[model samples]
Target: MQKGGPPPGRSSTTRRASPRCSAGTSRLRRVCQLRGLASAVGSCSSPASKRPCRGRPESLACRRHGRSSVDGRHRGCMEPPATVGHVLALYPLDRPRAVGAFDASTRNDNLRVVDAGGRQFVLRRYRRNRDPERVRFQVRFQRHLEAYRFPSASAVEARTADPVVVDEEGFPWTLFEFVDGEHFDFSRPEQAREAGRRLAEFHDVADRFVGAATASLLEDDVRRFVATPRAVVDELRDAFGIPSLELELQNFRRRLETIAASLHPERLDALPAGWLHNDYHGRNMLFRDDAMVALLDFDKLERGPRASDIVRGVLSFARERRGSRVLRPVFARGFLAGYRERRGISAEELAAMPALAELAFAPYAAICRMLQADHQDPVAHILGDLQGMRETEAQCAALRQILV
Candidate 1:
């Protein structure tokens, strides 16, 4: 077990039921936000004590596998009052006074837990996108990271010796030792630089883990890139009648094709590859004193060329919080400079980066929103991607100039 983590064995404390709190998830969030007042919140008593805990029995948001029992589980929407019945009953931890969201963890899947003994934990639920095979694959990689002492939020196993717990709703969940840190402050070039170094270290571990399997993973990446643009266009045209769409799309489509043309499968396949933390942006990392402490949300973890992660990381680190624009050469320089401290990149990889720029700037969220077909001008959503086109071009130029 990771140090300071809850014990993995079954709890002798019998399952205690609690009444649904009127405020539900929010009240727990409110109460747990202050550690000093934890005891003031209502809590579930042991079976020996008949006091009903104050909270709703809501769905525990976890990285769910749905491979276990759904019996005696909370169904429908999250009730949250049954903190003891769900979290405590499911795991071997001591009674918790309040459950809340983790720092910067806006998703429902992750929660900050503080037990009576003052032990801290993160209850991570696979509430959405719970593919069991993918969950297992990620868990295997996390364990390998732990073996390497890499600072990621690795799941602690249950008494059953499995990290994932399928609750009554058949959702998968895991508990992790609480990591202490905050999101990277973008103003600090050193943080961006440090993140680059850490990413290099992370890539080193992934390289070993992937080993002989790198070829297949790169192939998977090619298939996705080759297919996504067509799928995006087809989905839009079929659903929204693309020709009727305004002028923005004509330019957008041309730009998309140009990006596609720049990246041929043969050339793309030839580039150097490694396991990528597909979403390595600032929001997904936590830092302390400019040093990266924990890398979070490996849901998109995949194997691909190092550039897929590198180019994206540089963009994300340098992006302006107000305008969504990158900070140009300065932030990018810090990132790559620190990256070079730990790993070596070929000039070939650097050259491909300019062509990879538009591809890296994905419009997934916009495309997904347009797919709902609610808007008369559904295809208009992609105009957002065009707004940054010139800036993206400028950044690419800046990138080419930085290494020199």
Candidate 2:
């Protein structure tokens, strides 16, 4: 929710290039070139007729004079591109704006603290997903929580009253009212307790939601990828020219399969199900002076076992000191205690937590392998996770005592 800074690895400071006041169509591509995408096209061009720059839509370029009053005029030099500035303008705002990316891992984000009229908002370009139904359900669910006054960021409709808008290259983007608070600090127990309390409130409100947003069940997800034959890893390793990694990946696969074999897939599925934020961690939560102010990022919201969400939170938010990846007892105690304050986590749910948490690596590591198609190094994230899964057995026994 912080504003006015470029994302990591980007220049923190920005100065606008010379303004383009030309009325011609050729001048339209100037915004794209300014952003450093040479292949980027302008509004006069059709993305479908030609290949888009880096597969992104040319419609992302902002119009110096918008099509409507509500769209607002984009004036002044801002750190971000014209497309982002235009998207931020989609919501009703005054002119004289400043924009930049925020600290987000999975999506494109522009955080604007104050518009010309001093209005604050966050414009987010969601990761391009093929599922429109899922996007709709997420929008509705956030509205549902906002109606109840839950402390969370809700999507604001665009100028056309549509909750979501498609860019020219066909990507979904939305605007959010700026949440004023510091992000949750994991080192603080009180902050963690507040996070736990808010999470319980979220689950309670989410239980009543009925929508068509489809999601893969966690256990089923593990089954799907863990079932991949050992040869698949070998093939991927050779294809990617990382043949040396085959032995390590093979060992991880064997360990993952063993952990997968011990899980009660049917029982995990049968355990009480409800709407989950799917991703509940410190970074996704906002806080003010130690109290949680808002929970952000509901894109992964889904129907799943409540316990799965709890363990995911623990894994994400809890401390892992001394390089041991084990859940901190203190954090676990507070979170479980807070969750129980609203609804009870049954014995079955508690018992399955450790194994379920361990088996999570199967799908996660597989996705990292998938990311290699884009030439990203998945080693940094995967190495620690695979090692943690290998070492979790001893820690699981200790964690069970504290959990139950």
Candidate 3:
């Protein structure tokens, strides 16, 4: 959630050039060059004549008007261009047909699918211009979770060995086994309790796998953002015209510096390292029959503070309340109970919660601001969230006063 600079490796806008095919060798090449049968007729054909040209044979005839012997029936050469929707329709899996598609805030394109067998799955396509290192880390993390028997959706198939499937148009695609469950509604206390318990279990198990070899997601984001908070702040100021928000961001950056400085070199050095599900949050989780069942979205997985994963759940679910109460204590208890059942949290660790919580929220706040600045109706969303968070702040203050 931190206001990091662009992700590592190449910017998401960069596109890899398609491999050049020899002239007139492949049908696709002919299609690209507009020299195929379809192009020729497309130029002179009336709109009414286009009605008969729906298939590949008609298209070939349109482009290569004089070549009667050119067979349109080649492997991988279909009449119409294959789109993501078309490819998904062709998914050989026995699931129900996809009825609709939804968009997420991330760079990935996600589609909801119901297979022929009435089962559901999510088809995610990563941006083709993603960081190779991040992509590798995500795939590795999936493998790790599979090995550890984590309650996460398994990867169905990737377009490439590298965990990305580049479409003919160069978009990267991947599919995940659909986790059938609802995301927890924080309005209910019981749900909060369950979320805590599941999150703790995730952290305890995830912590054991952390090793020195993996890259730290936290350090990466923090370093990137801290390096240029001023630029981000300036941009926000120009967009929002809120000087106070800019000051708050400056204060947030200073606090981050303080936390960074206070982090013990020895503790970090001694801390266990392994794959952390960097985007662990309520929305990324699925529940069935009143129990947490599956975790999804491992794209942000990386090596970092074991506690960082736990903190994501805390900040995400515990941060905002509209008409509801602050459920942190119940959540904290449930989470710690589950976590302690595997690996207990120490008093020192508990003391660090406030700082960690802030760190987790800062980047998220920045991301929300960024999105609002770029998109339509983002202001309404931001204002609504602010109102909710204000309510949550009052509830939290009251609860804290009582607890103290």
Q: Give the winner by TM-score.
A: 2
Per-residue C-alpha lDDT of model 2 across residues 110-214, encoded as one tens digit per residue = 444356677777766654332445566677888888788887777777788877776654456767788887765657777767777778889888877765766
Query: How accurate locally, in lDDT, is each candidate?
Result: 0.59, 0.58, 0.47
Q: Weakest 10 consecutive residues, lDDT, candidate 2?
A: 70-79
TM-score of each: 0.72, 0.74, 0.59
In candidate 3, stretches whose alpha carbon ends up further than 4 angstroms from where it belongs are 1-82, 89-91, 94-97, 102-107, 127-129, 158-163, 187-190, 207-220, 223-249, 257-274, 319-328, 364-404
Best by lDDT: 1
lDDT of 3 at 343: 62
Q: Give the lDDT of residue 283 in candidate 3.
A: 69
What is the TM-score ranking, best to worst? 2, 1, 3
| Tens digit per residue, CA lDDT, model 1, 173-208 | 777777777676867888989988988999998877
Candidate 1 residues lying further than 4 Å off, grouped into runs, are 1-79, 83-85, 103-108, 210-223, 226-228, 239-250, 364-394
Output the better candidate (1/3) by TM-score: 1
